[model samples]
Target: MKKILVTGSAGFIGFHLTKALLERGDTVIGYDNINDYYDVNLKYGRLNELGIKKDKVKEHQLASSELYPNFRFVKADLCDREYLNQLFKENKFDYVINLAAQAGVRYSVENPQAYLDANVQGFLNILEACRHYPVKHLVYASSSSVYGSNTQMPFSVHHHTDHPLSLYAATKKSNEMMAHTYSHLFNIATTGIRFFTVYGSWGRPDMALFLFAEAIRKGEKIKVFNHGEMERDFTYVGDIVNGVMAALDKPATSNKEFDTNIPDAGSSNAPYRLYNIGNNQPVKLMDYIEALEKAMGKKAKKEFLPMQPGDVQKTYADVKDLINDFNYHPNTPLEKGIGKFVEWFIAYKDSKLK
Candidate 1:
């Protein structure tokens, strides 16, 4: 049983990953600030599912899960370097998965400082801790948004991502660079997974799936950005978690074939690598909505709007590296994924009402 530290353990993907690890007999320390980026109640609800009561969680204090003996949770901010160092020094973790970040592209437009604080400074703290503590593997979350302004059909890790359209994308790109630096200098086996549009049960309210679901429930108009001209590789959260586990099991190694003359963007001579964890199936925005409508038993009233600032037109992830390296393929059908999400959403909403 490996001892792992999962930052952003209260978030959507983080929560699912933590549960999976615990079920697999891994000792996990779930850490999160439980920030009010969205509804705190939803975060608390997720924590509750992990046998961590909302009242039991205190800042920097570890709360043991009642349901899973292998799981423990700590409420803390990623920006707190001193606390992070303390936590790392206390626990000799086998692996560390850094998923905590100030998410959302458009939100970054209004508050760029948040991204810098959490994504930039917060990530530096994780790197420092890993450098000092020396973990077996360090896996962190990157996003498909990094492939900004690149009209490539299937976005590959080899593609040039120097042109980020939004602050969020820029910060995510900076994360990959920062991670590569640590891997090069400290020999930290770091792997960055660029996630596509992940959606499922307990998803972020700010995301399209959740927004559309809520609007449809209220008989309100859901804002269709880019006038429904958008497309996304809508990967399920379950698939993402499985991909992360696969990557974590296989630590990155130096690429002997890496030629400095034409350096590959995906892998380096240093112990650093990048992979895209997406469905590889780009679903149209309108089609995605239709699937959701079928699941919810109600059609959404969409408010067709111009493309918002800091938003990309489309995202399609090329998972060739993921398939070749890990032999893992994310094949969860969009309709099935959306159906599961709707079921969970309705149940969760009803629970909240009671």
Candidate 2:
């Protein structure tokens, strides 16, 4: 079994990916700071479902069990250079997946320093550790927000991503650049995934789907930004996990015949690559709300409002490259995915009440 290190293992994507890796018989060392970016209880609740107790988590502490013999958890901050170095030295992971970051565009506007500390400096520390102790592949999360104000119908990895509308988008784009530099200088196999609007069970509360679901269920008015005209490539979480696993399994190789004169943003002469992992099916915001309403068996109290600062009008992903490279295709329909999410939401709420 390959030993893999997954940062942010308590986060939504990380949690699902870790479960997948564990089920595939891989030895996974999970790391997370478990910061109170949202609800601390919710984070702990996720860990509890995974059989990890609060007391077991400590700075650099490792926990394993016979039931999930290959699974382990470490409570460590990625920004801590010494601790991260120690983790690299001890674990010697075959692959490293960095999914931890300060998420949310509007949140970045209010807490710019948090983004600098976690997304920039923290990512630098991960890259440095990888440089010192080489891993087979490094897969990190990028965002569709990197497309910024582009008028393109579907955002493609080959297209130039020079404009970022928000601090969160800027940090993600910066991560791709940093990864390219590392791949160029150190020959590290790095792949950056520009994820669209991912949603499903165990999703972050800050995300639109989860927030709207909770508010609507509570009989509260749901904010409809941009007068509910926004469009999003609302991808299912399971599909995203498949894309990430595919990228991790296939390490990027340098394009020997890459033309320097007319360079492509998605590929390089170095061991680096980028792809957009989305459903490739953009849905109108109102349509998405309608799906949620069907799942909830109730209509949301709508409060139409102008677009919030740092929010985009629409996002669509061009996943042709992802399909060509990995045969990856997202198959979940909005109605089906929303139905599953609603089921989980009800169960989770009941469990919380108990």
Candidate 3:
């Protein structure tokens, strides 16, 4: 079995990916600080599903799950270098997936330092640890937000991501650069995924779908940002996991056709690669809200609002490279995905009240 280390295993994408890996018979060490970025209870709830008891977990402690014997959990932050080194030394991880970051664009606006500490410094530590302890591949999360201010439709990995509008986007773009540097200097196989607006069951409450569902369920007015003029390439969490696993199976390799004179931003001669894992379907904000309303069997009190700061007008991803390379196809229909999310939200909300 492949021994893997997945940071931010308590987070939405990390949780799903970790669970999927464990189910596939891989031994996984799940690491997360479990910070109160959104809701610690939600994080713990995900761990509970993985058979990890919150009462038994402690900072820097290693806990194994009863349900999945191959799965282990570590309560630690990425910025803690010494502890991270110790973890790497004790358990040599074949695959390292770094998903621990201070997420949210608006949150980064108010708390810029948090982004630097977690996204920048934290990721640096991961690279350092991988440098010290050789891993087969290092896969990290990048965001479509990195394409900020680019009015181009269907943003591709080969597109220029130099015009990031938010600190969060800047940090993600920095991760790709950092990964490329490490790949060149240390020969580490690093793959970065630029995820579009990912949404699904047990997703972050800060996400649009969860917030919209909660507001509609409470009979409260749901704020339509940009006066419902926005569009998003909402991708399901399951398909993203598939793409991630496929990439992990095949480590990054140099592109022989790559020309340094006019180099591509996605891949290079170094063992570094970038791919956009999105649905490639940009749905309008109004249509997304309507889908949720239909699934919940309720009408939302709409409150038209101007676009907030650090927000993009639209995000449509070009997944041609992802499909051609990894054979990864996100087949989840937008309406069907929304229905599944709505179903989970209703049950989850009811359970939380009790």
Candidate 1 segments exceeding 4 Å error: none
What digit string (tens of lDDT, one per residue) describes model 2 on residues 102-158? 899999889999998899999999999999999999999999999998988888998
What is the C-alpha lDDT profile of model 1 across 1-354, one tens digit per residue?
999999999999999999999999999999999999999999999999999999999999999998999999999999999999999999989999999999999999999999999999999999999999999999999999999899977999998899998999999999999999999999999999999999999999999999999999999999998999988899999999999999999999999999999999999999999999999989999999999999999989989999999888888889999999999999999999999999999999998889
TM-score of each: 0.99, 0.98, 0.99
User: Any residue pairs clashing in model 1, and if so which?
Assistant: none
lDDT of 1: 0.96
Error of 1 at 236 (Å): 0.5
Clashing pairs in model 2, backbone N/Cα/C closer than 3 A: none
- Residue 116 in model 1: lDDT: 99
Of the two candidates 2 and 3, the one with more favorable TM-score, higher being better, is: 3
Model 2 stretches astray by more than 4 angstroms:
65-67
Candidate 1, residue 93: how far the Cα is off, in Å:
0.9
| Candidate 2 CA-lDDT value | 0.91
**lDDT (CA) per prediction:** 0.96, 0.91, 0.93
Q: Sort every candidate by lDDT, greatest first.
A: 1, 3, 2
* Least well predicted 10-residue stretch by lDDT in candidate 3: 322-331
